[model samples]
Target: MRKHRRIIAAFLLTAVAVGAVNTPAAASPAIDRGALLAQHPLTTYESGAEVGSALTAAGFHTPSSRYGVSLHQLVYRTVDAHGRPTAASGLLVLPRTGDRHLRTVSFGHGTSVYRGDAPSVAPDDMFLSGPAITFASTGFAAVAPDYLGLGAGAGPHPWMDVPTETSASLDLLRAARTFVARQGRTLDREVYAAGFSQGASAALGLARALQGGADPWFRPAAVAPISGAYAMRRVEIPAVFTPEVTPKLGAAYMAYLLSSYDRLHDIYRDPRDVFAAGYTGMGELFDASHPGPEVIAGVPDSVGELLTPRGRELLLHPNARFAAALREADSVCEWQPAVPVRLYVSPGDEQAVTGNATACRSSFAARGARVPAVDVGVDRSFSGMVHEGAELLAVPRIAEWFSALAGSH
Candidate 1:
């Protein structure tokens, strides 16, 4: 049992480490949810100069005053999967020199295993902060959600669960609007949504919700989801069963999704039912209490090796509940977008599988939605091109895309 445990943990950790390099997780202290249910700011960076100082201190370059930016950390009320009211945190960045009515861009972050990687706590974590900063520098309001259970929120992060991710992100955008107004600022009613990897799926979910009339107050201007995992069951799930996946990445994401889904859907009666003997007791590894690379070091290679026989069976052919979760998470691209939409893919992206974007584009085209798929030019293989290329190349471009749309509208 101990030997199996060692192997399972190591392999899972390795899978996560590989994926973590491409996307991103963390642990956090407990907080009182009751007091923070009203959706308010926990802290604020008073001026662009103050933000600049903080950025400089954090080893980030301070941009010129094209549009000076300020930051705020918010704790807002949202619902869990069951519609139970819960608290989540996020960062709201506003441009100081914008026309009183600032255009908004909701930037969803990629997969992060650390709580500190959240924009509210560590905006510099995902290369995401740079884009948020860019949005602000370009005179846009950037709302970056910490998502539930991360940052100052209590309990486990929901990982890639679509409903929670959508709700958390939308609620943050709502909270940001209120936060802005309370401070004598105005926001343009429309929002440009964008993200990468897990975040890309999240952004699309928000766009779907907004287009579906979940929130009429905020119209969709444009959406850019770069290298999102839209077709998990089709592309990602099958790939994990083969060596095409890195053991570290498979372990990391599986542990994250399974553990998170267990919270929302009660998929596991006991951790031992799904996990190998070695990893049954280590549920805290993905609870945001630890970094992903450290967690990956402890997991073995391959999701199949990390799962029990029954667990492996479920992975290959999911039951109703499991299938439902995947279906829901993967349904981001199914809905039509009323606004302009661009699906960014990388030819080199192994983590997100470019096919997901292509399939998504096809869905949009079939539905007569104004959607176009762009392949960003990253041709490297697994280690370099597939994972980090989108973050390094696509994010800044996404900001520019958002800027153009915002300027036009």
Candidate 2:
């Protein structure tokens, strides 16, 4: 029996090393309740055409051949076998230079807003260039999804709510595979996910969905969660509400809640504070105050500029519960990984409490994940904090780390 436990542990460690979680011996509730993984509704190239229409509306279009390489851009939609509305839209961002073993990295993009401001655009939106293009430039078949709502239809971006988002995510990849297969092109399951900020939330959601649920193709080659949020309990929105939290922090929190729980508009400190008074939209209000980019100059002081009196009152509600669900929603450790797991978080990050990474590390450690929690360059002036502090330094380190671990396999 002791030898058997050691074998199970060894297999789990191997799986974690590869970023996959082995399914449990017994059936789990998440699988029993949510939409299980299945095939996409579309099978042929002609049927996959409508996805282009969705892409055009989202301000993304296939690249006209430039400088020798060609790129394809389109929005894709499909209903899973379970009938959940799963959709994906992203850029193929490159012209095939050669027949390289086109590696694919389906980025789990950061969090997004409902409809107000510009930044609220889905994280996968090309306008927000960060990770999608970076990986594409490095020779990976990068795929990004607008999730279910940010670019899909309406209501509930889910905020790491798991079930729906994971379903949409897994199916999006399945859809991509189907699209590629129809074109007579092939790509490796070298398929991986690098989730940052809110994208980390999406990554974990998809990871849990693939861990042991009834499918095999859903497995990711490796997963790296940078400044990952493990459970909603660590997501403290009230911390952002305090005066010391800064305008950017408060604005992000209020805007997120406004979208996540729109029905509670009446309870806001000032409805206009979050969204414009006449505003009925679901995304953030991208204004002079809500600028793009994480640069210090871009952080706004006017997050509260659009507030209505009632909005302020609602925001001030001390008993708010948004933070609770965000942290409590995920369990990266409970579900073991089949591939290696890597976690990156700055020791000095002001946005996410230090404990967030600690929790994720704890879970990974328990499940036998070969976790190496690296600093985001916050403490290393030698590593350089300047602008990338966490975001910049973390990206390449992620590439290097994954390379070293995968070589072992």
Off by over 4 Å in 2: 1-71, 78-86, 93-97, 114-127, 152-156, 241-244, 262-328, 379-389, 404-409
Runs off by more than 4 Å, candidate 1: 1-65, 379-385
Write one digit per residue (lDDT tens) for candidate 2, span 1-409.
Answer: 0000001111112112111112332422243221222222211112112323323333332221111223343334433223433333333433234544455666665554432111112233333333454454444555555554443223334445555556556655665565556556655656567776666766766666666563465456778877655643434344454453445655654555555544322333334455654443324442212223432232244346534555554544423453333434556545678876777787655555446677777777788766778765563332232212454456556655554554554
Candidate 1: tens digits of C-alpha lDDT, residues 1-409: 0001111121122222212222111121332221233332323445656655654543333353255666667776666665655667777777767377888888888777766566776643435465576678667899888787766566678888888889888888877778778778887878899887888988999888887777768877889988888888888877766666665577767777788777777776788988998887447777766765677776667686678987777777887888899899888888767888888877746566677887788778778886878766773331344665665556656767777776675
**In terms of TM-score, how similar is model 2 to the real structure?**
0.61
The TM-score values for the models, in the order shown, are 0.82, 0.61
Worst 10 residues of 1 by lDDT: 1-10
Model 2, total clashes: 52
Every model: Cα RMSD to truth = 8.7, 13.9
User: What C-alpha root-mean-square deviation, in Å, does candidate 2 show against the real structure?
Assistant: 13.9
